[model samples]
Target: MQAAHELSQVQLLSVSIVALGFLYVSWTVTRNLLFSPLRRFPGPKIAALTRWWDIYHTVKCDKFKVIHELHRKHGPVVRVGPNHLSFSSPETFRQVYVKGCATFLKDRDFYANIQPGLGPKYSGLFNYTNHQQSIDERKLLQAKLSPSALRQYELRFLPILDTLVAIMKDKAELDLFAYFKFLMLDAIGDLAFNQSFHQLESGEEHQYVIDFNNAFTLIGLSLKDAYYGLQRVFKYAQTRVDAFLSEEKPKPGTLMEAYLENGKPKPPYTPWYIALSGHGFIVAGSESTSITLTYVVWLLIKHLDIQRRLRLELKNVPPDATGAHLASLPLLDAVIKETLRIYPPAPSAMPRVVPSRGAEMEGINYPPNVRFQLLHRILNFRLR
Candidate 1:
């Protein structure tokens, strides 16, 4: 009788578990399809039910294409997730990104997975979700990156460009992308940290650079299921980088020196903070600039007539031309503008959270906490 009772208890437990599972599924379906605020927005039904739709395309690293297609199919605004909308219109873009209208905060959930294991404190400018914190952190280096300071840095670029030309002459055919990556890495290393990565000179890659690049690729893939694992790898890479940087003594006038000295008065700059900031600059600065330069070069090569015009314009300037001088060149400026329009380094959606007061765009009012993104690539492509 005791054996029979035990068996009955086990059977009852199984039935209860199955019932709970069924109820959970039913409630989710009901909420997503019939009760959710985003239900009226047009998108694939599966997307409204779960984030799996977005995750799938993200893992494929074709999220931009997928979102672009969705926008084309569903119009300017498409419900991409249960509480997420994507906008592809100039008015909405202005509403979301312009200073006066950009009341919405960055979606922390999206950035949370970006540089995982570093915590919120280490998130640099691009990934920092907290507006005030981002502002404060940016203020620290504002002077160094200002227009006047940048002109001083421009002098350093001449030798690097000369080295790049020298290197290319030796090779019958070259991968401009790789060369650009090397050039930018070395440039940022010297300009930001007063050290040269030597990638351009040595024709060898640094392990830290490689690791950070891998981390970036993983993050770009947006594999939520692999978030923890990706974070682990990123943290390990960061630890190695921090260890490397800690061995070097701070040099005068370098950003690292400023960071170390700045710690004396107020909130101390931890070693991890300094290291992470350096890593952020290396990754963000090098990658975007290299990609942009590569695209600019490619575009120029494809359009010989425009390239010839630009070359003629450059010939008219002095050999030791300054950025201000270059800025004055109309043809050069137009070519750069056209290249950037054609190939933005990061042609992806920048997600933001609706403010607590709620927000309205394109005649649709959205409640707080709804995640929406401006499709930059779509907007740029429309310009063409």
Candidate 2:
């Protein structure tokens, strides 16, 4: 009878909690539709009520298309969430992002969600939304990715490129997607740690590479899944940093090993934070570069005349030509940029929150806590 009584009490508590949750959601939805400042913005009534509408489209893999459609239906600005508006107008983008950047900070909630449990000390450059902190972090990391630093890492890529060419020679037909992904992963690994993944030689994906991809993919669906998956990536980076730091041999000047000045880490670059930075670096670099390269290759193949022109342009670039030499190649550079414009690897919304003081854009005064997002639609040039 005591056990039965306890079970009955537990059931009652659960029912009460669910009831409270429903009440809260309903109250918020009512407030959003009837009282929110963003209610003036153009969007479907359902979207103005809650963020679930946006999440649904995100999960359905059509958020980009859907957002563009919303813009078509409701001009350049469309309300995407209760407090969020998607901006595709060039003038609005320039005003909000370019002219009023100091007032428009990166959405704090979004960056906080990506790193999960980490504090500001562990927050990487990408996650540092504060204007000053972002500037400072960029100054610190900019050295590691500068022309001179990348030139050092560029040597490591040569052997890998030769290996890639050899692999292509052996296969009459091959899926370039995996190869491109592996190639960039290997390059990023060398740039992050003092080690190459050697995936081209092994012809297999590394666990670290696989986990990084998994974590990024699942991050959108569930924060819990992202946090755990990212933990694996963080752990892998830690292991690599540990091994690299402990090596008795002469250290290579990779991002990890380069942090040492006079055999000790520089200010704000302890082993753990170095690992965190490397985690950010790997996450930021790999897949996008590979995607860009793959699309460039595919587009070139489709337009063989342009490809022939590109090949002729490349022949002029000497085998030992540095990055400066490559940068000077007009057609080569144009093709890469054109490909990126046509098929952006990350064609999603990047949201920035309006400062507490509010913002005026294109004669509209937006209240604080409003999320202003930039979409790829801005890249399209209409026949004006």
Candidate 3:
């Protein structure tokens, strides 16, 4: 009986050890099965696991060149992480951008980092639910940017531009960057808020404008890193941004003010959300236009003959003539077009989530919850 008891104990010990081994084996097998496909899709192994690796490379090196090189080597589509795929082909761009058949929408992770906060739920851009929402916002804003509206804005803009030209007139070797930024600030305030930043007239920069610019750039640079659950660090950064916006009071009759007065529970937008959305439009409108002009100037500096030609075209226009007359100048317009094509302000990949039903891509089935990016720069360049 003693021998039988000892044998039974030994058998129990063996069974326990076997069970532990099976559990480990099962875990290893599951990880391999789930993660191996991503491994095969082509990217650094660390990037395949987390976006931190990709973000590190982008922050450390020339971000644009690094991403471009990755796509050039990896074909039109490459997995940047477990969930993210970067697409470079025009066909994908057309399907995603033109056809508007994107299954995935903007990642919430991207927007949750907004510092001052998101704008009105129904404001110009940020609050939209679907394509219909986007359409509605665009339609509302379209009238605001139409020829008549632009003409009105230009009346306000010309005085600001003239003030800038006066500063540049005798001031030799001006810091072109600073003056350009000031012009944009003034323009945005006048056009969007019906207030003067006075950046041009005062010949001094607005503290709020500078703070907003610095904060905005820092946020964009950190977005990818923050998206993979790095909220602790980003939230701290956002806190500083929130402080900046707090210093400036909202302008009456401006979008932020309008939302504050009319906002309620029944509408499509909230007060804070509308304020945030207004911030986006103001920043986006000013910065994008400024950057485009900057690139155009850079191009002209490289090709002095083009600069002279543009000058000649401008000189030909009568002082009393409309901005539309100059808009028809093909060469000047071409320069603008080329600059837009080359250095697209919106260069990053726009993300979309795969539908819950699952979708087939390139003859392989992508399961639900997969995220894809449509790289605008890659698509436009490849077409060239």
Best-performing candidate as measured by lDDT? 2
Candidate 2 Cα deviation (angstroms), residue 259: 3.6
What is the Cα root-mean-square deviation between model 3 and the actual structure? Answer: 8.0
Model 3 regions lying over 4 Å from their true place: 1-40, 114-124, 127-130, 214-274, 361-365
lDDT value, residue 104 of candidate 2: 88
lDDT of residue 91 for candidate 3: 62
**Per-residue lDDT over 1-384 for candidate 1, one digit per residue giving the tens place of the 0 to 100 score:** 999999999999999999999999999999999999888889889989899898888878788888888888878888999999988888877777775233777887787655554445656545677777777777888877778877877777778988999999988998899989999988887665567778988888765566555555644555553454445544644564454455545443445544644323134566556656666677678988889899999888899999898888888899777898899899988888887887888776678888888877668888888998876678877522
Candidate numbers sorted by lDDT from highest down: 2, 1, 3
Off by over 4 Å in 1: 1-11, 100-102, 118-121, 216-253, 257-268
Weakest 10 consecutive residues of candidate 3 by summed lDDT: 257-266
The C-alpha local distance difference test score for the whole of candidate 3 amounts to 0.63
lDDT of 2 by residue, 25-141 (tens): 899888998889888889988888878898888878998878777777778778888889987778888877788777788898787755544455657656778888777766766
TM values, all candidates: 0.86, 0.88, 0.74
Measured on C-alpha atoms, candidate 1 has an lDDT of: 0.75
How many clashes in each structure? 0, 0, 8
lDDT of 3 by residue, 1-384 (tens): 999999999999999999999998676556643655454566555566667766776567465566567788878777776677777766666665566444555565553444433333323365343666766666656656678766756677788888889999978887676678778877776555455678866767666565554444544556543332223323332343343335455333333332333333125544334444545656776767878888888889999999998898888778877788778989888999999988887766557766788766556566676677765567666622
Residue 16 CA error for candidate 2 (Å)? Answer: 7.5
